[model samples]
Target: MFMSRLRRRMGRLAAGVLALAALEGTCTALAQQMPAMPVTVANPVSRKITESIEFTGRFQAWPQVNITSRVTGYLDKSSFVEGSLVKEGDVLFSIDPRPFQAAVDQAAAQVKITQTRIDLTKANLARAEALKKTGNVTDATYQANLQAYQEAAASIDSASAALATAKLDLNYATITAPISGRITRQLVSRGNLVVANSTSPLVSIVAVDPIYFYFDLDEASYLAYQRASKRKMDAGDAEPALKAEIGLSDEKALSHQGTLDYLAPQVDAQTGTVTARAKVANADGFLTSGLFGRIRITIGEPYEALVVPDVAVGQSSQGRYVIVVGADKIANIRPVELGPKFGSFRVIKSGLKPEDQVLINGQMRARPGGEVVPQPTKLDVPETLVPDPN
Candidate 1:
């Protein structure tokens, strides 16, 4: 009887243990099936994006001038401070005016002397004519007096020319600025002898406002610009004004706006590149001459393009790519060709469609071929991010 009771108890204990094991296995399977990873996704933004090309260039001032003396004399004094701004017609240097002033005064005295002689000659000639009419003077004497009067008049004319020349030389004694600009150091200081029309400059000046930006475009870019210009002309429309943006080497954002003003007529044979120039305003005088700058030119017309937030883009051995969430809630990597960046969004030249949903936030949680619980969200885009049509 005791043996049979012990065997029954063992059988019941085994059945209970088996039931508990089955329940635990079922609970584990259900937990594994539950979704754990959460990710934020959004549809790719569709907009008309302008494509631009970048080039390295330098800033140059317009109307750069080398200031030199027009007349030879000892340097007297300068009206301008070194490296200071000067206005047009402002006297820059005053040469030794004593010599020029003396010449002018001497010429003036000669003119007065000549005028007195002319008066005396007139009086004498009148007397001679009167005597000749009364038959009191011989014909030879009258003719000789007339000849003397003509000679005196000729001398007065010569003195007048000398006076005019002297005044011009006096005016040249004071050197004035031809154009408004920032002047360099005085090459010839006070008390130093300077020669007229010398090759060496006394100072140099460069115009700050409305500066020029020069850059080189390869043959391919030159041809592209020409084609676009030609197309506009053929359509009976005015040539579109090309625009450029510039930033200094130390700057990260392009803040300067400029207009394309010049294009080389021919390409350089040696470099196979053409020179291009843009005019930029420098009202505040922030841009200095010979500054290294980065420039971007809008070379293409606006077109529909897919753009994703810069955070959405990733990189690997396969280059740049983005994660897109499909209808099955699975993350897939889409390789893309990138163009210029527009604000916080990067222009995807390819590998993305307008309706495609891309993973924006929680990128780490999302992996290729992996399931995700996608939460739809909106992207923050700037209103003025698009390029101006004009």
Candidate 2:
């Protein structure tokens, strides 16, 4: 009877242990099947947006002048400070005046001497005329006196002209600024001999207060711009009325605004591009010549476009893409076409629908063909891409 009881107890314990093990196995299986990862998603914001194009360009001074001496002489002194603002008619440099003054004096003395000679000849001619009336002078003597008088008159005129020329030379000895602008350092210092009409410049001046920005537009873009403006190359308007903006190398926003004032008459065959120019105001003298900048111009009319934050876009070996969640709560990869950036938002050309939910956050945890718990949200879109003045 004891052996039978022990056997029954062992069997009951074995069955109970098997049942416990099965219960634990079922719990482990349930734990392995986890819920979907949560992610933040939002529908793309649709709005009327004007497309803009950007190109690398440089700042240029429209009226740059190279200062040079008009008369050959030793440079006496420079009147203006280097790198200083100068106005029209301001004395820039002065050549030695001693030689010019001496020339003027000599010309004036020559004029006086010619006048004295003319006076003496006039007296002699009067005497000859009186002698001729009295039959005391021959015809040849009278003719000779008249000729002398005429020669003296001619000599006086020549001397007077020489005096005027000398005065002009003296005036040119003092060099003056031709235009109002910022002047560069003096290349020819004081006491240096400078030749007239030389290619070497004494200094250079550039107008900064209405600077110019120059860039090149590809042939295709040139055609598109012409069509958008409704103006052809043969049109009477040389400058299109398009507006342009510029951003410096270290800048993000194109804060400098200007008008498209110049365009090349023909496309360059070698470069396949057309040169374009803009005029921008530089009241503070911030824009400088030869500085590399980025120029932006609106290409076409405003159209409706879907946009999302730039962070939402992802890059892959193929190209740019975005993760979108569908109705079934599954993440899918959608290839995207990108346009210019508007502040922090990026324009999506295609491959995205207005109603599709794009993953903006927790992108790392999301994968294509994976289940996700999407948290719906909205994007803050700006009315205009322009930065606030404040």
Candidate 3:
């Protein structure tokens, strides 16, 4: 009975070991047959992009004027309200005209007195000429009469000049705006004495519309712009107008467009930079002088380039990179050199080919060497890109 029990126990132990081996083999097969993680991929989109450089800049009023008194007098009244927009030629301030008008009247009376003196001198000279011709007058007497007539004529000319000057002084008493712009507060109050040719300004005005923008470009950027301009002219095209885009500090992108109208005659030796200026229309008067902003200027012509959406580009310890799926359906991280942004897409300066498949979605499931099932799709690019106000 003891020998039979031992034989049954041995048989049961062998069967249990064989069942465990079959179960392990079945799990290995199931793992091998599993499908790859699905991911969305697209080829780099071809687009026309231009190379550009950006700089920090500020907005300035195109023409700013300081209002001052041309003639000395007491301030009579002001025609404009403080902090108001004034039209060109609108009256701004009025100096006391009573004093200037009185001076003009005095000058006019002096001119009349000189005219009366000239008549008397003419009559005496004529009588002297007749008496001399008849030998009734002495030669010395006739000579004196002639000299008197000449002196009277000269006196009248002097008096006439004084009258003209007085009239000009009278007109200057009424000050007018030299330009259309917003004016500052009056520095001198009514009934206060104001002096002529004073360094102090009574008020200030700044033209806000069609504002000017000033920026400095590095030496390298200046040279590149010159080269690109020359190439454009050589191609029988108009010299490429150096255009600029501007953005305020709060803005995300440059949107306001302007033309680079003026460049400094020479570069600054100390700064090693060239000064550039641009003009932008500000009819709404939103942009103001002394406001700091960013500016961007294109230095190259448009050319075909490979681009990918900004979100697809990733940052890592190595640098900027993108995940590219190869022919073997394996995801590989590619390090790429990046260029300026072109709308929502980023310009890939290098390390990307137009034919390479880039994974755009399901990045979390992707590993550097992991296999993936890529879903091919077309990249939709906008027909027109809105101007970026730098």
- For candidate 2, the per-residue lDDT at 139 reads 100
**Steric collisions counted per model:** 0, 0, 9
List runs of model 2 lying over 4 Å from the truth: 1-46, 119-137, 231-239, 303-379, 386-390
Poorest 10 consecutive residues by lDDT, candidate 3: 381-390
Model 1, 199: alpha-carbon shift in Å? 2.6
* Candidate number that wins on lDDT, 1 or 2: 2
What shift in Å separates residue 375 of candidate 1 from its native position after superposition? 4.1
- Residue 119's lDDT within candidate 2 is 98
Error of 2 at 328 (Å): 14
Model 1 — TM-score against the truth?
0.74
lDDT, model 3: 0.88
Among all windows of 10 consecutive residues in model 2, the one with the lowest summed lDDT is 381-390
TM-score of 2: 0.69
Cα TM-score per model:
0.74, 0.69, 0.79
Query: Cα RMSD for candidate 2?
Result: 9.4
Model 2, 1-390: lDDT tens digits are: 999999999999999999999999998776556568999999999978887677888999869999887788999988999988888899999999899899999999999999999999999999999999999999999999999999999999999999999888889899999988899998987999989889999999999889999999998789888887775344665655788888899997788999888889999999999999989999878888999998888887788889898899999999999999999999999999987677678889999999999999999888688799999999989877642211
Residue 356 in model 2: shift from native, Å?
10
